[model samples]
Target: MTAIRANSLRNGPDEQGRFGIYGGRFVAETLMPLILDLEKAYRAAQVDPAFQAQVKDLGEHYTGRPSPLYFAERLTAQLGGARVYFKREELNHTGSHKLNNCIGQILLAQRMGKTRIIAETGAGQHGVATATVCARFGLPCTIFMGATDVKRQWPNVLRMKMLGAEVRPVTSGAGTLKDAMNEALRDWVTNVETTYYLIGTAAGPHPYPEMVRNFQSVIGEEIKAQFFEAEGKLPDAVVACVGGGSNAIGTFHAFLDDPSVRLYGAEAGGHGIDVENGHAASMTGGRPGVLHGNRTYLLQDADGQILEGHSISAGLDYPGVGPEHSYLHDTKRVTYVPITDNEALEAFQLCTKLEGIIPALESAHGLAEVIKLAPTMKKDETIVLCLSGRGDKDVESVGRYLGLIE
Candidate 1:
């Protein structure tokens, strides 16, 4: 393996947690001290051997670390070009990469003596993951989900309740991920003394954006090791779907400094990026702005008011993207693209049929981009897509959309 370059792209957020012009703690004054305390606690835990040990142990025994990196033989032949591989995060406990961050944050909460946990989820994978860890640790968890998501992602809502989490459906604005986040932040600010907001993605305030990325970085680390074992070298590319961009940042973190590995992030292009309020492709269709405690690309109007973003996959409809993604786009280190709803739906069926692996609709966005990209590369080249979640939670909604169910 080659050593990381001297001026590595992996080093970021600086001291104030600003990644270039993006990412910073822009929040209400009432929440400042709480954010600071969380930052301090996180820093101390970063070097605490016992804390790190607990995270590692839980990941291995509970969440199932070292998710496989499997070569997609049929997919490669179908593409008729670059070899395709999948980093099977869907096989992890709770069926998504969300569990990786949830496990670490729950441990941190325990260390901080937090008794109540709260979170915001779009696709509901993060909510279920958070609720699962809370049940294991015996802490009360409250999840805020957009009303639309609560209706569409009922399976996950049921799973969270089964794990003992109270699901609060937010109805304001678009009834989507952005509104759910607003409610979560309000709850955090109101109950700052007793509550810990376990953010589900690599976005939000200073410490959260960086902290979540650190926790999820295991995906990329494991991918590199597993790929070396299988192919004896680095992959030519890495791809992932980006909502608030947790999984994308997770798998991209380890490859940021590798000049040879091209990184691609697929955003939800609901209908199309050009269609007003018809897509959630913040990076591709929106511009820089602040929302949910950080500066990033957001879908907004001329007055700078946040606009409702759309996506068939509930998770990828957030109006703003993770701040790190904004920085990556500006630096030209990663290519950000949009995948329309129809394209994603087609890719969803293709993957399930060809691989017998049902992918979350959110994951299908990444696969959709891979379908377009893989065929363009050399046959000797290799590409690994982060299959972020399984499709069980999405089967019902997708079935309705596909006209397979009444």
Candidate 2:
């Protein structure tokens, strides 16, 4: 077995603030001042024991940290050869793992004296989660999303509005998550003073990937502790869907040194393999390029025009991924694969029917991979899957895809 150091996994930006050729503050001159201020505040608050306590308290009392590690008895029996366990992040506040990070960021925003919060969301889980925290803290909130996402994820859009956030829809480009993110960046550049950009994923600039990862490490921390208490041994594998890679990173962090524990990140395979304009398998089909301030694997053309990525799950339809994921893929520490749309849809229905659990479309990608892999594994081998979010946001889209809706 290859011995690995846990400390080595804890990495940040270079002196110039880049994460393995990805991540850096890229904002207009106006926002640069605010970015620097945020960096200083976040760095300080990060080390402050009192601030950490506050974040921890919220995680326990409010957002419900240590979400259950449930043995998937039915799923295991169905697979017949392997045991499956689910880290029930779907039980967390707002019905997703997103709030785990939002709560931490909002607390940091408050500590930093930022008055408003801004975020870009695709499936709206992150938007709704951020709005929920904003309401909890009495902070103003704004969420930018693609017009298409707003229509497809209307329930969550309504939830955000009900939570007192202004949900703006961006109609440019493909009018999807990427365009929405670009619009949010523009908003940040213009309103950096009174607003704190509460990024939902680990794909953004420095401090964001590091900050969101720290916020999300709760998943790994809990799974490890719970595995010990439940099985007296570690899980044989950890699996998660990677959009911007936050959830995968969260689930994989603690297991990095456990050489026998495999890690899998499932990217959206949209329709199929990388036919031009078809898939969101960025890790599989993309090349390193700069998009939205970070140098990471991006689906772009030769001239650097970012191409629109397709996915059955809006959340997973991204052009680029977090740099750490890029690093892990390159180092072969983690295995990255793509799950096709039909496969994910089948998994979505199977989980709903078999386990009585309706997972978010984004999370269905991971489940689909599990469906393919579990039957072939050893009966005693355990796999822990990060159920990243609930499926409410995707019901309409799925209905439409199934021709149940006009």
Candidate 3:
């Protein structure tokens, strides 16, 4: 919908993979060779028509991409302000946008002759997506998940196992997403030759943030064309939830050069922003620090040690955000807002009742922001909210929250 740019949004991270002062390769020496190799492979893949054709074919048939951009007629009428559209990524295969990146990375892994696939997951969506791809390719797969996430996202854990991927629970450091990532990295270091570390989000070392963003950018690209076809104009604001920031970055990438299109990212404000250890709103409540291989805004203590992040949405309960988000925040290219667990829950139910769409809790954070922003805008203005995942994996958690289940 926004006026197209002559060049695609690809001039980020520079040659050294630094998005301003935020992103860079900050991993250990042992992983440097593998990282460099991955960079080379990715660059080659970028220019190879055969690689592009393979990825595109899989995206169309396997992942069911070009997900719809649907106008939320009921929600728009109820809000009585701006028109709201839902970018239905939740409708994609594996029940989330995670599959898009997984499909791309798996193709790269195959091309690189990697025999094993390893990944880390928070809410289990990424793990399930990775496992699904591995199953399709008949490649051995292993997933590292935080002990806490293993308990909370049991459905996804079961899904991963059913897909024939081994799930390893990580117990270090709060036993959450960050710990799972640490364990995954250690595994990559140990088996770099045989294994391809399939990172879930748009974070990690050089190439990863860039690679994931490029894969996930399909969401924004589709939205741009679909919205233009439907409404003849770009939405005034685009919104998505930020954890490791894949979905947010993807949804915002195509519109970066469109000055009139504002971008909003909703972060997890667990209990309340004021409460210590209560939220995962990294950009809003945290300072920049190094974590998980890149320098980014992180929830940390006075000694610079990382702190545990809290959130009802397992996917969003991370201490640090992707480095590109840090750069965007620093430059005020995107406005970051915090949405509490209660607010997200309320919005989750509201969307379900109004539109018959049950969004993942991670996505509900964005819905929460949409609820806040929609009422303040003029009726002619529009907002496009990225519904990043479905809520089937989270039904049990929601039932427990509502005291409808034990």
Candidate 4:
């Protein structure tokens, strides 16, 4: 066990948005004015009581705040060591924690008087969440998705369409999340005046990683209160799967000041880290580089070209992670582990059978880590992992993988 350390880990992302050389406003000069405007608007919103009230009200009513913290009795017994608990973000509206960021951003966009909206999605949960909010707010929206993801994640594509968002399949390199983000950035650059780019993850230019994390921090805030109410103390560990690290940072931020609580982030290892470019475990097998906007760990070749990392979960297919995650990883505030597709698959079935809860493949990666570490800890210790999203969107892809369907 680690001893309690001093200094608050929560106060991060200093003035220029650099999280200890990990994050910054690394964007084109053409976008500087727009980025600055966004930063100003976000800063103003931070101190506005009315804005905060609206965000909280929508969170509670529209997106369903305070998602239950359910004790996983069967899972705990099966692991036979640490007690297990699930922070049920999958029960939120749009079937994932993505809505938490979407709700706050959409409201912020309204405050800025932006009428058109656009976003990029990997596994489609973010697209669905963005589209759902745009529809609720009566804004015209478009979503960029990789062609590969558009096919594998057809159900989510349909969900976005049903919510009245135009889906554009990006057929660029890898045709995955990175490509989708590239396309989204291009759209933002072209239509910066009236279009509000709603980045789905916390890996974009300055203010975005910071803004999204602030909105999603509600996850940890509620977990703190709920866990205290249930067990009268904090969880020994807090774990979540990391794509661009929004959910992981959200769950880790509240307890940053409480050094006694250990934090873990599970990254997608499509096959294994030993297999070059075969995994999406950025922190485990990546070098620091700039991608999208901020400087962070990126899957890149020796020549500095970004590599296409593989993962069974489309949501975890990103080549880079959020900058704060990079800082956390460097500072040893959070332990990062790579979970292969096979491991996630096994963990998915185990959780489904034992707890009767089908988790998103992204969530499954975190579950895989929990399953491994839980059995090694004392029986009284507690481990709480984020059930980031429900498994409904992934049933078809998983069924095909297991040969349960044609």
Candidate 5:
């Protein structure tokens, strides 16, 4: 296995600000000026000691950085192949990994003197995270979500509202995450002078993909240290679920140079083999296209209209994967797989039953992959899965599906 070295992020930007043809500021003329301003401010902030300290302090005190790399002994015993390790991001503020990027973007927005923040959410984790950061920083926040998601994830919608953010429902297209992103882009277009679009995923225009990944790389950094201490070396494999693939990228970044560590990104296999039946396996079924910002792996039609992605877990129901993931796939540095909704549900139930842990639906995709891979591997190997979010938001949907919704 050839290890994918993460050399680009450690270096300065190339002429076009790309991470080896994976990142570029592909945007409309209307947003170019504002995006350029953000790029300039972000560059300045990267060198500012005060800004660095502020972000670091907030990460420690607010978002609970350095989340534990806990060994799942019970899970390991049950699986009986590789030792199971979990990068517990579910314990972070807002109960998801989304807050890490949100905090950094909010601080950058503050440095740039932007007074308003806007975001899009599907499962509402990202929306809640952006709203939480805005509330902490005393900035006005607006979150756009699909009308369906707004209703399905009402608890998070309520959390965002309570945090003083205006939650707007997007009724366009399929009325989901993609539509929410479209609405957010429109809002940014209209309010470009005073608002900063805090994109939640790592798939957006040039700087966002790079910026968000940098903020999240802390996950891999911590995991690397912990894995060394625990196993006297690196893990044999690393895995995470992919929406726009921020969490997976973060977890995989540290292992890129390890050569022996196999990286896996589990895509949502919705309700089957047929993409229409159940799947959001962007890498498995998508083509290159432009959507919110950059050209990447997108589930689109012949006319280039984005398709509606489906998943039992709302967070994984995005129509695109990050550009970097597309690059990784092309380079054969990482393996991308699909976990069906049934497999995820089984893994979710199994983890809860075996270890008394209820993982987020998004994370369950990674767990589902473990259920598949573990049984076939030798008992000496190790697999570390990034549990990107907690499962509280999914209780209602799971309950309704199981006929337990009161």
Candidate 6:
């Protein structure tokens, strides 16, 4: 890996919230005023020292910042290639990296005098995280989940309910994440005065993609410092799973200007990429289109209607990805790979057996890519993988898949 001068990759979305031409406010006219207001408020909050201080304090004491970067000796040895490290975001409170952005947004909601919170979730990690924050703040929370997701990720559904959030099951459009997002948007439009729409990913209109990435960038910031302290330099490569791409973007942002460090995003390949409607490799299989308030690569047909995506990991089953990822794809800054369900499952079991870590199915996609890339690199080189969430919520699903449960 060769070093290069630092670049301005961080100054993204420009003034109109676009990463090149990939992102913009493509919402209904009724929602335009709210989006503009949010952009203004977010820009103000970015420079507010008091607001920054509060978020910092909560990150340290409440959500647990600086998640460890642990060297995976056993797994690295098994792969027999580059040294491997895990950024353990699964250890954060509420059990995933989703809380990082949720906490920041919740604080912003409070500052704006919002009284109600609404969010959409696919795998339930974000929903649970949002519900947890709302419970802590004593605010009413309503979570919209696709009916399919509610059934598949029932554990998280139960967790959200237990946290006092009203779980509304959306039955429209295949009953998945995209549908839930649509329902959340409608709810926000009707209740804009008192409701805050907390999006779970680094996708969505305007300030959302920018703001979520900013909040989640803490992962990359901590990684830069920790890797320097541990290995005395930057990593050779960084890898993470990309659904709507928040965790991957968070882990990749700090290293973007480091030309020597390669980046990889592993998308869920449910069965195989060749099987029709069988995977969620949006960048690989789809084309640019507008959906869910932004223009980006989408899985659509000849008539341009969005198609339902498939992935063993519910989180990655989406038809589109984050706009920044789209920009990165166009510029060749990152390599996006498709890892199939069988591949991810094998990696999941291997990580559990070798490292004693039960990774979420989504994180297993990253591990699968690491397994593929590590064996080709020199032993001295290093790869850092983001362990995005714990597998506790996935154990039952895995058991069912493996026929260990009735």
For residues 190-264, write the lDDT of model 6, one tens digit per residue: 998899999999999998998999899999989888999999999999999999999999999888888899999
The 10-residue segment with the lowest total lDDT in model 5: 1-10
Scored by lDDT, model 3 comes in at 0.94
- The collision pairs in model 4 are none
Q: Which candidate has the highest TM-score of all?
A: 1
The sequence of per-residue lDDT tens digits that candidate 4 reaches over residues 43-91 is 9999999989999999899888889999999999889999999999999
Error of 3 at 67 (Å): 0.7
How close to the true structure is residue 88 of candidate 6, measured as C-alpha lDDT? 97
Q: Candidate 4: which stretches are off by over 4 Å?
A: 1-6
Q: What is the C-alpha RMSD of each candidate to the true structure, in Å?
A: 1.1, 2.1, 1.7, 2.3, 2.4, 1.9
The sequence of per-residue lDDT tens digits that candidate 5 reaches over residues 355-382 is 7888998999999998788877888898
For candidate 2, what is the TM-score?
0.96
Q: Residue 318 lDDT in model 1?
A: 92
lDDT of 1: 0.94
Give the residue spans of candidate 5 off by over 4 A: 1-13, 19-21
Query: How do all models score by TM-score?
Result: 0.98, 0.96, 0.98, 0.98, 0.95, 0.98
Q: Ten-residue segment with the worst summed lDDT in candidate 1?
A: 1-10
lDDT of 3 by residue, 23-136 (tens): 899999999999999999999999999999988899999888788899999999999899999999999999999999999999999989999999999999999999999999
Candidate 2 residue-wise lDDT, 117-222, digit = tens: 9999999999999999999999998999999888888999999999999999999999889999999998887776788999999977666877788789899989
Q: Which candidate would rank higher by TM-score, 1 or 2?
A: 1
Q: Tell me which residue pairs clash in candidate 1.
A: none
